[model samples]
Target chain A: MSTTVEMVRRPSSGAEQAPPSGALGRLRWAVVDGWVMTGRNMRHVIRSPEEIVLYFSLPIMFVLVFGYVFGSGMAVPGDGSYREFLLPGVFVMTMLYGLGATASQIAVDTGRGVVDRFRSLPMARSALLTGRAGADLLRALLELTVLVVCGLLVGWRWRNGVGDALAAVGLILLLRLAFTWLGILLGLLVPNPDTVSVIVFPFAFPLTALSNVFVAPELLPDWLGAIAAWNPLSATVAAARELFGNPGTGGESWAAQHALLLAVGWPVLLIAVLAPLAVRRYQRLSR
Target chain B: MTDETSAVVARGLRKTYGRTTALDGFDLTVPRGTVCGLLGPNGAGKTTALRVLTTLLRFDAGHARVAGHDVTRRPERVRAAIGLTGQYAAVDETLSGRQNLVLFGRLRHLPARMVRQRSDELLDQFGLTDVAGRSAATYSGGMRRRLDLAASLITTPEVLFLDEPTTGLDPRSRNGLWDAIRTLVTGGTTVLLTTQYLEEADQLADRISVVDAGRVVAEGTPAELKTRFGADRIELVVRHAGQLPAAAGLVERVTGGQVHVDRETRRLSAPVADRITALADLLRALQDASIAVEDVVLRRPTLDEAFLNITGHGASERTEVAA
Candidate 1:
């Protein structure tokens, strides 16, 4: 290289002294910055796929644990394939499991200065947050796909046609989106990434275990059953099971139709509760 | 570094975190085609002021215009006008240097072809051509820093904000950075820099502002601030440890100020306005008192001393902020 030009790593090259040139030009610049960060984040996930594998493995592992170990001894209060009854439970639990895992990603971003890097850039305020939500939702959808493939191999089949299968995936994706928002809210509210696991354990245990995903909603205790039926995860699982005839349980009722409404509603409610809070917390982060 | 216009201006800037103010009625003006250094020690609101200017943090009170647009009212426009290398970021460790620069170019909305071209150009310019394809995770601290700066320039911003551009670098890297900055300044780009290193300010800043406790205590050319706030440091290394007393007395007689001695170093030191002339008189008096002198040196007070005098604590010492 010639001697005229030297390498520089200064945070600012010469920005503080130059005059403003154009207005439209700068807005376009920020939009572009968002895409760059999005690509960077997605690439990071590609490099470290351990989280993806673990997330996908969870539902399949839960299915085996319950089907062979608990299925024969357990009854749905009727003669139905216990495998079919348990399948829906595992699927719903898989979707809800995304919440805490999503939080850990946000916490890591906060700790690693990735958030700080974007905060200092010319990118839009919503870009980074929106990008994170987008990435996590996609991750959840991928995890769902893997779990569905495993379910198919394990004698779980959807009776509904191609359209219904797409709709099932869509419903699960939407539910995961809601959970992801909740995860983001928690990540933002918490102080650091290290505390994320501690926070995650509490949310994971009850949200996954007490829902209709593992046992029949009716088998739960009088007080717990009512709460279990209301879990959005329960609604989603019931809807999917209604669409696909689970291994042996063939009870498709109006509850499946209502499950659609609940699946959509849960995310809306989560966004209602968490979106603004997350934005406000993010706004204060750079301070 | 194409010929660019004025990058930033902040007038009547004030910010308070709870009851403790971070920036108290601070004002700054940076003209086009020059490097303006925002020189200050720790906790002096330099970062706060930069944050406000970058549109990262909003001030409770004050009018700030970056790239000729109000920072609060038109943040995106300000962001468009400048590039912030960022105070605490390096490269995206997951990406190669070339990928990082290209990604930033794409984010700035450049055409895909142009992004590739710009990335290549930046890699060549920053001496990162060889490692352009390697992930930044494996790069040294200095290489990562260079890639970070390269990322910042993907848009060819008219203005730049560099906060402590060379704090932890070795001398060679620091000099390389200084040369790079000089080239940028020569080509008429605007720069705002904040640094604790006085020599960096003296070498690069068109003007220096000494900030302490969230206020600019002094602002001028390095020589001018030194003249106004700095006194000559008259130091005496005693011939023998016992001669420290006689040497201290002679210094007191010469300067009419109490001489201070560090018990550990066994040296006599005093402040005097005319360091060069005072040195001659001090040597003569010490000899007359038969006080042997091991060594003597007269110098202007360093910014460290000036910071202690102004802020009442060494800049290096950490003071807990009331959170």
Candidate 2:
């Protein structure tokens, strides 16, 4: 206890300087704060559970609308159950919708000056960003779990084994991690609360609905289908369809093989591209 | 700058947004352990300068050093040694008062145990122990300000920056904050405060620097600044508008300074020395002149007068300060 008191009397032992460059050091910090603040974020949700009820129900309503009302007309490229094929689309769709709420929370923080307070404090520079990303990833996981539970209630099932199902979950989370940075980037870009929905809604639909989340890309118009086929979300849904027992058949598209790679690649690439710029921008807000 | 103790030094800080310049070659020097007031009318670049010194905003040109460390080059070390409370109380509405302090303590890298102890100590010291467990959203404005100040002290920073810390506060709350600031200064913290209220600077600032349009218009102790631009003012209210002429002549004869007569109010005003004796003589002279006087008042120089003199009708205030 004396040692602890003595330690506080001296300078902070945290990253006063920049962190040492290595995978181990970076990942160590990423995981340490990743877990602590993730718990804290979850506790905030627990206390204000009503705040998320709207987010939880909205997408489930959309999935039901698409499955029962729109599924008969919509064509899938492969044969077999539409529920199996549609489930991956719904999973990917739910992940994309998570960005809207998360991004707006950041805008609220920005407006309330909480983001500025975080910047002024002498913490791990990356801790705030990493904690946010970690919590959003957790939110994505929870959202995925709920959508799956709802799917089960709706008589939806994946024919894959335990490992394959788990692999599909990993792939969906990987997709979420990539998109979370994109959400943070939007949050950083749009600093005002009133304009957040204006920014997130258009991007959410174009990125999610225009892709294979509900229908096969070939079913889209010639021009629209071309764009949808290359969207990274389309790749994720296609890859999930294959990994979760090929709800259609063991088919492959150019987007399927590379989309997951891009899904994994995008988050790292985004953190590389957007995180520093956003941190720098966040630092100089009133400047 | 003038052999001041120099706790903080800033030179040529500049920032521009589009076509307008917010700060232009601004320079400042603050002595250690003194409460320095950055007194300015609106749009005077006072907030810009404070933001740069606190390591929250970067300047396009020039430099600032806080507690002997360059803010630009060593922002982490600078941030470690400094605390800032903005004009608005930026308290998290979600957290309780104690939780707010503990959150800042943890962000400042205090251990869990120390965060707890220091948070309690601050709550007690700030007269907030009873309400510490309550959510800040439920707090009064004064309580939120106190908690915001408490959060800044979690690390016991050496240099504290307050930007209009008492704006919108009632008289009682303002004095309470003044007392807290004095206590901190006595404990060896250097404070740079910007305020629009002249009385606040008069009561609290060891020295006041009046900024106008991105420049320091005047910098000196309250006495020195007042003496440079002020004199003893004597006002006499005559019985009628016709008597203003008699009052003006009698005042001018004694003081030999210009007498300004308001015909509507039947009052005569002039600058002089030994204003009380002057008032006594003027009263006697008024009797001889048969000018029936109603009342008399001596107006001494206030920081308000000094502020008006230094920043007379500055248009930049439109952008710098808000009601």
Q: Please, what is the whole-model Cα lDDT of each candidate in the order they appear?
A: 0.71, 0.74
The DockQ figures for the candidates are: 0.24, 0.29
TM-score, candidate 2, is 0.87
Native-to-model Cα distance after best TM-score fit, residue B98 in candidate 2, in Å: 2.8
RMSD of each: 5.1, 4.6
Give the worst 10-residue stretch by lDDT in candidate 1 chain B: B314-323
Tens digit per residue, CA lDDT, model 2, A1-287 = 00012223423323233433577865664565455555556656665778779768876886688778887786667576676678888888888777776677667767775555666765555666567778888877778888888888776777778787887788788777766776766777887756875778887887776887777777768778777777777777776776677564333455555655755665466557766776666555646
Interface root mean square deviation for model 1, in Å? 6.0
Q: Which lDDT value does model 1 have at A40? A: 68
**Candidate 1 per-residue lDDT over residues A1-287, each given as its tens digit:** 22254334322423222223367644554454445555666777777678656766777788888877887788764666777777767766776777776687677776664454566555566676677777777677677777777777777677778788778778777777777778888887885777875888787788767777777667667668667677778778776766675532323334434776776787788788888888888777756
- For residues B1-323, write the lDDT of model 1, one tens digit per residue: 21134567777788888788889888877887678877665777888888788887878877888777788887766776677765655556777888778766654555687678767877887789999888888887677767776676776566788878887878877787777777777756788988878788889988777777666776777667666766777887886787777778889989877689975787888888777678889888887888887778787766556656666665546563421
Which residue ranges in model 1 land beyond 4 Å of their true spot? Answer: A1-38, A77-79, A247-257, B1-6, B232-314, B317-323
Identify the runs in model 2 with alpha carbons over 4 angstroms from their true place.
Answer: A1-44, A72-79, A218-226, A257-286, B1-5, B127-134, B237-244, B262-266, B273-297, B314-323
For model 2, what is the alpha-carbon lDDT of residue A114? 57
Alpha-carbon TM-score of each model against the true structure: 0.83, 0.87
Q: What's the TM-score of chain B for every model shown? A: 0.84, 0.89
